[model samples]
Target: MCLLLGVLVGRAVPWMQGWRTRAAHRAAEQKLDALYSQYDDIYHRWDE
Candidate 1:
């Protein structure tokens, strides 16, 4: 039915958007953590 398809599509769009947003957030967090670790390593080396 057209109505059923419409409903399914409506629900799917938001779900897909949310999934993409979460994935992006996770990637950004990982990048930030990597950067922090690299900075920390450099700082430690400088201290020695």
Candidate 2:
């Protein structure tokens, strides 16, 4: 029983950490996209 519990914990920990990494990456991508959109808008306005 102890061995089984240990194995489950070992596997679950990394899987949970993977979600943190994914969330960080997603947030960064969104920030970059927003910045790019703002830049495009400014450039278009300047062109007009």
Best by lDDT: 1
> What is candidate 2's lDDT per residue for 1-48, written digit by digit as tens?
999999999999999999999999999999999999999999999999
Candidate 2 similarity to native, TM-score: 0.86
lDDT of 1 by residue, 1-48 (tens): 999999999999999999999999999999999999999999999999
Could you give the C-alpha RMSD of every candidate to the true structure, in order shown?
Answer: 1.2, 0.9
Scored against the true structure, residue 12 in model 2 reaches a CA lDDT of 96
lDDT of 1: 1.00
Query: What is candidate 2's CA lDDT for residue 30?
Result: 100
Kindly give the number of clashing pairs for every candidate.
Answer: 0, 0
Q: TM-score of every model? A: 0.80, 0.86
| Cα shift from native, residue 34, model 2 (Å) | 0.6
